[model samples]
Target: MVEDPHALFDAWLHEAEAGEPNDPNAVALATADAAGRPSVRMVLLKGHDERGFVFYTNRESRKGEELAANRHASLLFHWKSLRRQVRIEGPVSPVSDAESDAYFASRSRASQLGAVASDQSRPLDSRETFEERYAAADARFPDVVPRPAHWGGYRVSPERIEFWEDRPGRLHHRRLFVAEGDGWREGMLYP
Candidate 1:
């Protein structure tokens, strides 16, 4: 009787952290514009709780633009080592400025510098140009690099969550949780 998707997600995430060889927090983020043209890319899950799944990005990036145009988004977490996947659909909202600042502060100096230097989804004339920009940013912030204004996080407030686990003979297990008021209603789906 797992009524709370967060609890289930936590359990699976812990398992993934132990079993996955690489980034356990990696997730495929899907976003679409108002016209329904969908796009997806990989991003690291920075945080999660009852509030929803959180990931940071450049607000000027393609995904960020799409999120702004249409707040609806979806996240998929797949741990091939465990043969488990979780799908979450929800509306995304910007995290508090304080939250973004805190996370930015926690990041490595190089990462912070890179965030400031990189133009994200924008085109680059050459790698050297990008590196030069990064070098300038690096020189600008020799210490205590501040988070760029365009860099922040988004939280997907889930309306529905589905958990899938592989089973023998292709008889997989699937459970779905739909938000209901302050709680959730769980149901099993045929797999």
Candidate 2:
């Protein structure tokens, strides 16, 4: 009976942050190519708000390419310890370059160098080659590492959000919220 799905998600995520042992912000992101081929991968939730959920990645990566071809996507957040999960589906758009640059600047130096060195989904000849590339990047940017032009963040503007909570005797509580105009229409589902 929550009026705002974003508020409910914030509360659930707060509880998860306190209880989850690792990566409480981790979420499964699902995307599809222009041909309708689907792919799913785990990514950290960099930010979230009424606008939608946000995550960053290399723009040339497989997921990125897929996102470019198909803007619609889905996100799944499962908190095993709490026996709860949330599903989000929506259209996505890229975040501003300023946002991407700020986030990149906040990352550790090593991570910055790694991102610069990586070809992401592309095949690599060997580990040593990657190490060499990483070393070169580190040497090239001894001070500030600039975010690559191909690296950025994307925001998913949710059209539907579903929350599920576990209960006794195989019963569960499922609530769904669909965006309606500027507000949300809440409903229940059998689970």
Candidate 3:
């Protein structure tokens, strides 16, 4: 009986980093509106620990809005080279403003400007307009770009996590971890 899901995730992620050619940290974040309509998009996993999986985005963006409406969310990670994927379902919550600001400060200057310029998930008139706005932001903040109030991070506090590994002949392995009393209860599920 595996005890710690985070430890297992870390081990698999380390292996995926070595095998996956592209973004090993990429995960599909799934959220729903108040009406329960679902939407999924790729987001880079910024940080992960026992607390939750965290990713930063503009609060006005579609996912952020959806998360605001529906606290529950899901995440999926597929690593083709490693023939593995993980599914996570949990309630989501916003990270502290300090955390978001620190992460934003760690970003490249161009990225900071772009974050300020981008009205993420909103329609843009033209690429030129976006570039203009981006340039304006860059000019406005010649030294340091402050993190926009809408730009921040959210953490999904996992209630359930399942790890899957593909195998030949369609036979696969599935290990599920469900949060229990002060710990996790592991179960093997059919694939």
Candidate 4:
């Protein structure tokens, strides 16, 4: 019976951070193309707030292209250790360049070079070609690696949020929160 879905999500995320052995912020992002073909992939959740959840990727990546065509997506966060999960559906929008720049700057130097070298979602003849490209990027930017123009972040403004917790005897607790005018309308879902 939580009034704030964001707050509940934050609390659950905190618990996951403490309990989950690996990437606690990892989430499955689902997207579709203009023709409604669906695709799902795992991405690290970079940030979250009342506005929405954020993640960064190459704008030319498969997921990014799908997002551009559809402009809406769903996210699923499952914490096996906690036997809990969160589902989010929302419209997607690009984050500001400033935000993307800041996050890009925080990444390791090697990662920065990889981001620049990769022509994500594009065909590559061989691994050596990619290695060469990466090497070139490394040599070109010995000091500061600038974030590529095609690399950026997207925010998903949630329209619906659902929380599920496992219980005994095949029973489970499921709560759904739909965005209302300025708040949320909470309800229960059979599980």
Q: Estimate each model's TM-score.
A: 0.98, 0.98, 0.98, 0.98
Task: Give stretches of model 2 more than 4 Å off.
Answer: none
Q: Model 1, range 1-191, lDDT digits (tens) per residue?
A: 54578988999999999999999999999999879999999999999999999999999999999999999999999999999999999999999999999999999888998899999999999999989999999889887899999999999999999999999999999999999898999999999
Quickly count the clashes in candidate 3: 0
Residue by residue across 76-119, what tens digits does model 4's lDDT show?
Answer: 99999999999999999999999999999999998899999999
Residue pairs in candidate 3 whose N, alpha carbon or C atoms collide under 3 angstroms: none
lDDT of 4: 0.97
- lDDT by residue (20-67, candidate 3, tens digit) is 999999999999999999999999999999999999999999998999
Highest lDDT scorer: 4
lDDT over C-alpha atoms for residue 162 of model 2:
98
Model 4 quality (TM-score): 0.98
Query: What's the lDDT for all of these models?
Result: 0.95, 0.96, 0.95, 0.97
Estimate the overall C-alpha local distance difference test score of candidate 3. 0.95
C-alpha lDDT of residue 175 in model 3? 94
Which 10 consecutive residues of model 1 have the lowest summed lDDT? 1-10
Candidate 1 residue runs with Cα over 4 Å from true position: none
TM-score of 2: 0.98
